[model samples]
Target: MTDQQRAKPLRALVYGDVDLNIIDGSAIWAQSMTQGLAAAGCEVTLLLKAPVTTDRLVAPLDGAPGVTLRRPYEEKLLSDLGPRGLTPDQAVTLMTRLDAEERFDLVVVRGRRLASIAAQFEALAGRLWTYLTDVPQNVAEMTSTAVSELTDIAVASRFLLCQTEELRCFLESAVPAACGKSVLFPPVVVVPEGVSGPGAPSERLRLVYTGKFAPRWNTLEMTELPAALDKRGVAAELHMIGDKIHRDSPEWAKRMAKALEGTPDVRWHGGKPRAEALRLSAECDIGLSWRAPEMDASLELSTKVLELGALGLPVVLNRTPMHEDLLGPDYPLFADGDVDAVADTLTLAADPGIYGEAAERCRAAAARFTLEKAAERLRGYLDLAHPTAPAGTDPQRPLKVVIAGHDLKFFTRLADHLMSLPGLEVRLDEWDGLRDHDQYRSRELAAWADVVICEWCGPNALFYSQHKRPGQRLVVRLHRFELYAEWPRKLDIDKVDAIICVSPHYASLTRELASWPADKVVTLPNWVDDRQLDRPKLPGAEFTLGMIGIAPSRKRLDRGLEVLAELRRRDPRYTLAVKSKQPWDYWWIWNRPEEREYYERVYRTVQRDPLLAGGVVFDPFGPDVATWLRRVGFMLSTSDDESFHLAPAECAASGGVPAVLSWPGADTIYSRRWLHDDTAAMADAIHGIVSEDRFDAARLAAKAEITGNYALERVCSLWTDLIVDGTVPEPVDLQGAIAA
Candidate 1:
């Protein structure tokens, strides 16, 4: 979608199982999330499960523009109800009714059972953004039944909102279906204006803890903090907020009530509005979120920690990995979840030097979780889940497109990109082998599609060409291997509307072999996911050269070694990094004598040559090229021949220079500045780049060349125009530089 289209407001339905009349974390979250969603360009309709007896906490949302709050009592039948809120089933029923009255773009459901119940409804299918905060917190709790339930929820939901990275990782590991669909929806804090900084050194240091009281929350233990601090000669006052206490253990609850009633040096303010609580907390010297040992292993984060930080109060919490990441490792106030540790931390925090440092860390960290940042994150995820249609397309009826291919490694990213775009619905017809496809599924997809894109111009392309329906458009992509195969010659070229090639060189070769019209043939290069690849370079990346895919000996692995050896002769800092499958892994290539001999010689030379010894490193091949590219300063494209070697473009997108050997048509695809005559020349060019401190300049230029021509969005836009409107992008000049 374009920027102009994104400016339009999306209709959002927000529901939580918490009572707004009560002041707690979930209740406060519901209120602040409504405002956050509205601020993120959404017209939010917040459905309340409980009756609104007090507007103390709900007053902030009253008459707020683009926000509509609906209480359960608004219905005549529920107006005379008791103090309790609607049940989970009742909330789902009400939510379904409202959805039918006017369909919302997305529904944000807060509870697991409520989300599961909503998912069962046909009207709410594929529209639920399930924010599950009460899932299995540890690996031992991930039972098979629990995993099945979460997987079912993930299948029905549009997106799963995780409160922390730890929670997201745990859920995804338990339920693999939630891997790509889950997103981090951390606790958001609304920093108030003019939060007071560190107070001057006084005899007494005040510590505050807000939120409901529970044994797991260690509110009872927090009451002992003030007394323990007194033993350490650090005079302190413990101020506690909120009146609701967990009733799981009646003895613990009674002890907490008694402790709050008449504890020495402690003051209890029974539940106040969130604003008032923050106001009281601002007067304190430090915040307290120390928890029990049981909760120490929990994957969730306390919203009160950031809330306290937003109030400019340094908090003493557990030193969990998540907390250590939020506050720097050097943060001095991290306690070990015991009264003694907390008292010691409080004593250290009483010192002016330690207090100032901790206060600065809290303030800086709080800036990242502000309301504006939360809104921006929500807006981005919303765009991905529910995108606006491009200018003239109908958003209601998205075009159905099917892609049928055997090995779709190259097309998977593009297919995912298409599925995320508005005005398009994509499906893939998987094939077992090059020519072995599910004929029934292929025919079914062809009949269901408005457009069919066949990758590799194999039997799938030929089958679709012969089975073309009356108004359906057929497009086939011809890779390098397909040009030499007999499948391309057997296709009925008249039935095909467009023939896509990865490079102009391949496009020319395809045109010469096939009787397709000049206008029907087009060159669309492979897209580089620039956003994923553009990461910070590692230390000494300037001396590391990367080479990928050396199977079958045609990739010219020996030439890459030669370049590395030549460069190492000039500067011993140079090294070669190869990520490829060993030749023996491929039976067809390893069975050949010449292929074995070529690799044997290359390995022997690497061990025998002093300049290349201990310099060549082989890493296992995987799909995580983005992370691997961080240490790859220069990517070598020393292939003997290639239609479009995508490694160079990916390297360029990763802010690494491409040392490309001048293979035939290499000049047509890449800039001449990156192309070299031979291995020696390529090595010399890299040496010059390092010696003259021109690495950064070359990296920037190479990145610009790739991002300008082959970014994911740019190429996807071209594909969208082609599949949606039957508009072929302008053809490229094969004789000149193809990047232009």
Candidate 2:
């Protein structure tokens, strides 16, 4: 036979943790991939962990032209074995028996549990290809030895590829050896033939949502969109095509069912087969995938969105970087995962011209993710035997730096900087420990790190201290709020090699509060990228004062308001622009009686006084802080206490003068010349700058100060020396460090 002919009818095994019949992302992916491979001249055998559940529709895979379906255990047996469907031993035994009967040319493992089993099959190691559908760290907890055994890896998205690279760096695994063997092919669906063109405008817009009804999926908000549309005088109907509630979250399901019971326009079809679901999707005018961006949402692509688009339906999903990468930058039907936003998008889709344009874009974008295209990409990854050049580890292997934090914005930026450095490999562990308590996963990450920096003195620090390997350096960074919480006292300081504080004042306070040696505490200023800041000031900006955060009472927003009121009394043009989420919107603040009372009083003050109401503008928090600062002439830091107030420095970088309040720690961070004793003093300082026409000079001086001291490059270099080079500098006095 010729090479092409011999390549035909190649035997392949597709393995996954979920059963083929389940109405979920993983199940759909497994079935689609199997069908795609079979279509590409492969005689495919789908090996599942458990048989199809009776409650769900059986996948239409029986008597397929070139595909066979098999499961390691029956549903009854799975129930007997416990929650984990098929144990590794059972999988190994079943696969071994199948291989003995007829050896397969290729083995494709889907999901982590299946990958672990596939690793045990030494006979299939040369042809083993693992597909990671979840976060790499969460999915695979295997050692370097096990990782090195796999022939290739397939990731679902570009974000997943970056995440996998970081994971490989942390583990010091053989990712370099498997370089070209890795591919990023997002979840694929079968594109419908003769996709109907955008339909003519209808009186009522029809929207469909197909997925779990879990709280994380924002199903509650999705169901409420129709009611929001009704209120807007726009007729709309919602079609839900999944289970009444997600199998995992029964309580949330119950709540959603009760909530949606009274909504007349919502039609629930429960769970349907894949093909049927697609058919139902084709009838809808738009698809909805409006879920909160959490739980690997940033990294993993949503298959449901693609599935809907494949049926020629425009999707009203949350606007995210991942979605933006798939669709064009200007895809018009994006929402903010809120009912009002979804409703607004749906209303826009109601227009024929807009809907037609969006429909065309959705179909075009969906064409890129068809199963055939994904299978072709998979074939390319499989063709390379020794794909990647081995990574060099000469002159002392690069430092494996793991940053563990709840809020990872700052740490994420720091990590990106560290990754760009010469001798550092960075990994971000963003587990807050409150929701996800995976101790084994935590230990695995800790074991991989040469140095682990816990961003907050919370459970992350506690986990690392308890699980840190011998000779591994531990660093815990304590910010302001952590000092007030019980976590600081609970943190085991003995295991910590160093504690990073943003300011010397905080360093001193942390040293006093925790049992760590005073020598271990060091102050490092937070980095700000001057290029991103340093924008041209808006016209008439000299009269505008900006404040960043205002939710927490510790921010002393009432005092800032008092300052604003005083300034407005001098000149109505002097407006106070507060860049933060409204106080009522934050549950943590509004739920507390004392904090709520204070917020209500401040709110009433804004309502009662016309000057305060008109002068004070509450703008929602946005990504572009630097751009937002351009409208202001001065940045106000009227907080009760702060370790290092970033808003003032950020304002300074943006050519805005810093007007700081005389809080306990503020003096240590800001120069005493700019620090005010009271709200009236702050107003006077602002007036002095504006009246004397020294605004430009003051702005230039502020910009110069921040650029010289806290520039991104400078801060990154200091962090590199401390984290990668293990350089321990002597602690400077609080006043001197602040002045520097």
Candidate 3:
């Protein structure tokens, strides 16, 4: 080590998908590096990338103690990749930032994009380590070659990414300077950290498979194993848990169904959550990893293996270095990847003598992979990187609230801050694919819920109709979703506890509905601090007129166009910008001539003919939404009926004047009383509101005042103390009974 470099605290930056649903050994490895490095004594920070839609904000990740986390979007990682994965350049940019932020002693990059990200870090030389989580024969050659240039470091490639070629290049390329440790291979998790005590068994002897249906590991054949075990007097069943990349085609399920035909003990149960996948993995007496033959297939280790190992279950698999490395002394190797071998393993599993030893071995290994072990390893790495530890404390106290909604991200900026509020607990019902029955026959999950908060759609109505108890509180968030959908009307207005709208105007609209009482509903605007509101706009602010929301029928795509027309009339150089790359229901709107015509006419008459503005401009999911908000000197909203208007306020918060259209039910207060004559007059008002600079600062200040009303602490406090607990406050006006 260089004397000068050694004196400074070494800092290790770890990256991975830390999402609750983000399972797999790679995630565990990164989590370990994050925690272990911190415990191992380095100044460590963990960086995570968003796996869901870029515009949507997912929930907060409860990070490792004393570690910082971030979701860095090099936009290119999204929009461009047609679901295949991240591009080389996006990966490079992501890695470059991590490397650039203070000469990191070690930069640990895991999963997916290994090429350009690694190459850029390697370009920095001696400062980072490439912890490739795949075997030599599993990942693609190009990726391995790129990662090799960075370091030999560590290859815990149990749940490998890519294919054979990348695997070889990564394993063979030698760089002792990267790391001195031998390959840890894939971490064999016996008991994953944070799993609630063990899952109590239901009536079924539930056996489950965790990975997607791939040629590399086809456990469909193992469906026969349970049948074989059942014949041997072992009553058990099989469950599959994944979106199986091939689910789009009926042929895949048909093939899987065929594989399970004669397997009596095995019934295709269904898929589950990653955490549930782990719990199911633990519950089963045995876990299966059936890999089909491919060039690099034999070299692969299954994610289910580590999950099973963590749960202390015996695994029956094809002979692979992955299984061999993880199984250790309790190795159960099957030479052929055939059903017969699987059946034989099941038969042997029925005879506890054959599988008990392996299960015990798994039990011994489980402790090493607990969250504690990873935390320790993280401490070591971080201690070496950044010798002196920074202060360890969360200045903002957290709220303990539960999240109850169907498969929504369940996490957003507002929710994140709410979740971080003091004395709040959070839990979300992320499983939303259900049938929408009659109003009374809503979702079954509603009965167990404390609060019902959702972004309503056709399917969302199921949640709304589920009869809520008088004690239950239902808060319907009125974002931009109310436009052009049957959901708003379908929502049962009677069961609500408190009506919190993102905009006061939106709250006012609730009053006009006559269906809801005015006192029960209040305004709670989406707010951001001035510091976050004032970031640099994208290049050439004047030419860019940013409209970040979509939903053609109502999102004011037309209003944006009208404002652009007015600006162009005033100045020719101005251009309008929108963050919608495709039309809502693109197959319906962007495809059909009628839908397209309706969309075009709405924009041209209201917007396009006047100013050439409004189309899809993918949002740069950056530090703050205000960054994009500031791009336009103006923002506009022209919707027919809005429970609450969010984008306009965010625009105002971003230091821009938000000029809005006052339609029939724009917000309950805005009727003929709040507006002029007709649509033409509304359009004229929008033009005047945006074209003049006089309204800018004052409107932004007004926005700041409104958002402060919906501050995380206030919202969370209401939910925790009043809403969930049903602590209805003594109202000044008792005439209006609250409904969910």
Q: Residue-wise lDDT of candidate 1 within 1-740, one digit each (tens)?
A: 33356646789999998888777879878988898888888889999887777786788888899999887786643544556788788888878888889889899999888877887787887788999897889878889988888888898888899887668666765686775567778888875577564554356898898989998888999999888988998888999999788889999899999999989989999988778888888888899888877777878878888888777788888887778878977789888846887888889898888888887788788878888998888887777666666655665887888998898888866887788777777899989998898899888898899999998899999888888999999989889888988998898888999999988877888888886788888888888888657766766999999998998798999999989989998889999999988999999999999999999999999899989888999987765576678789999999999998989989999899998998877776787889999999999999999999999988998888888878887888788888888877765333343333
Q: Model 2, 1-740: lDDT tens per residue?
A: 11262324568787766655557887777777787677666788887776556423344566678888775555242334555566656665666677778987677666665565556556766566566644334335555554544323322111112222223332222333433233454677774576442464358778888876787788877778888999888988888887647657677767788765656898888778777777777777888887786633345667888777777788887776556766877888888746777788888888888887777787788788787787675554333221111123222477787888778766655665665443566777878553365666677788898989888878788888988788899988787877878887887777888888988788888878776688888888888767556556767899998899887888888888888888888788888898898767888778899998888888888889877867888876755465567688888888887778888888888888899988887766666767899889989989988988999988887777777778776776677667755676443233442355
Best by the TM-score measure: 1
Model 2: weakest 10-residue lDDT segment is 155-164
On the 0 to 100 scale, the lDDT of residue 495 in model 2 is 82
Clash-forming residue pairs, model 1: none
Candidate 3 per-residue lDDT, tens place, 1-740, comes to: 22243444456676653332344445445554565555555677766554443221122224545576554443342455434334445555656775676666666655435532454444544344444543343345436464564343333221122212223223433322222222233343434365421322333445567765654466556566556655656566886655443455587667775665545655543444445567656666666765666633443344456567667676666665444444563465343546666666665555556566766665555554555565544443333323321122122432223344444442354454444333344455444453433333234446655556654333553355455665556666554445345565666667655655555555565556535677766554443344335433433453555666566465656655655565666666667666554464466557767657767776546443434544324453222354345466545556665554555545655556555566544433222222444445544554555456444444545445434443333444444455335454321111121110
User: Which parts of model 2 are misplaced by more than 4 Å?
Assistant: 1-3, 53-59, 71-85, 136-178, 191-201, 247-250, 260-262, 295-297, 385-740
Alpha-carbon runs more than 4 Å astray in model 3: 1-10, 16-22, 41-44, 51-60, 73-86, 98-103, 111-113, 121-123, 134-206, 228-234, 246-254, 257-273, 293-303, 320-337, 374-740
lDDT, residue 685, candidate 3: 51
- Best-first order by TM-score: 1, 2, 3
lDDT of 1 at 290: 85
Scored by CA lDDT, what does every candidate get?
A: 0.84, 0.70, 0.49
Q: Compute the lDDT of residue 263 as modeled in candidate 1.
A: 96
Q: Ten residues in a row with the worst lDDT in model 1?
A: 731-740
How well does each candidate superpose onto the true structure, as a TM-score?
0.76, 0.47, 0.41
Residue 486, candidate 2: how far off, in angstroms?
Answer: 68
Give candidate 2's whole-model lDDT: 0.70
